[model samples]
Target: MSETSDAAKAAQSVEAEYASAEQPPALDTDAEDVGLMAVPATAAGLPATAQGHFAVVNANGTLARGFGVVSSSRLALGQYQVIFIQPVTRSAYTATIGLTGSVGASPPGEIAVVGRAGNANGVFVQTWNSAGAPADRAFHLHVSS
Candidate 1:
């Protein structure tokens, strides 16, 4: 058989196999499926149990878009850490991080710089007061409702 005819026969065989194969079920948002999951409703300012949350807030308390998480349940009464993967440009002394969302009538949770590295010293320090301007730092937050 000629190469052209052989190629056509191969293509036809492949197409026939695909045509006889069962198709995948349609995506159902209401139900969970492979590679898909439902997002549970959660209170504001709480991270989802399944996924971590991310945000970028300015010194003036301005939060960038795509900030926050969806938790399946309310945040427990405990401490949570906000690690800065990409530390802000502002000095840690001047930088402040806090949580904002529906936390009943009480004020939002308070977060302070608990651990950080000094830009000049390059040494990790445990500080309660906000200080330094490290490139990467994390804050420890106390959440109480």
Candidate 2:
């Protein structure tokens, strides 16, 4: 067959398989703005951590996008576009939990959190030790609730 005809046949085959598939792949939650996307747990389970090229601010109790951890002591990053989607209430507090990367590609890294803005008026962005450690650690946090 001609190249064009061959390619058309392959495309049709792919489409047929997709149409008959049970479900699509679950999207990576860590890559979306907080309010714009709501990612439920997949077969792998809910995103236990956010791991991406972007920094994510997971609201308290909400899973961090893009990254997750096999254990609390370590984390892996993912890719997500993060933003402050909603504002907290007067009686509520906003917490910023940050997970830092390892030194020279090592595991068993460190994490830091900063809580500030009077429980309802703070914004945060994640940082790393290369940014400068606050108290001799790889990460630091300032929180006020």
Candidate 3:
């Protein structure tokens, strides 16, 4: 009886192994880049015909997924570019970029931007200026990079 149970378990294990072997190997979702978020900043001091800029404050040096907007009310996934224009406002609200992956852990490293701005816990800021204040703009993060 005990031998029969052991055989059954062995058979099940073999079946699972076969099933997995038949399918393509799973991707390495454990990669540090996955889901990312972006927020809007102000466009103050820029000329009426000027475009603003965007900035990111990465406190933990995590690799953000991506950045963009949603047309619908649902918080669905969307893709945003690395640049945008912002409204003319005095105060600016720094956006937060969150990173998620397989283990869902933030990568331990310094922050960098398009071959510039390399520092830990620093702000990756991009702006369009018309003189005194900068124009408002939107931006997205790069993860697969």
lDDT of 2 at 22: 88
TM-score of each candidate structure, all chains considered together: 0.24, 0.20, 0.18
Stretches of candidate 3 off by over 4 Å are 1-81, 88-97, 100-103, 110-145
Top TM-score hit = 1
Q: How many residue pairs clash in each candidate?
A: 0, 21, 10
lDDT of 1 by residue, 10-66 (tens): 999999999999987766853457335544546854435433334333222233322
State the RMSD for candidate 3.
19.1
User: lDDT score, residue 94, model 3?
Assistant: 42
Worst 10 residues of 1 by lDDT: 69-78
Residue-by-residue lDDT tens digits, candidate 3, 35-145: 332224346553444343433322322223323211111111221123222222232334433333344544323222332133222223333323423323223342221
lDDT of 2 by residue, 80-119 (tens): 1122323322222222334343334322223443322443
**TM-score winner between candidates 1 and 3:** 1
lDDT value, candidate 3, whole model: 0.34
Regions of candidate 1 where Cα sits further than 4 Å from its true position: 23-51, 56-61, 64-145
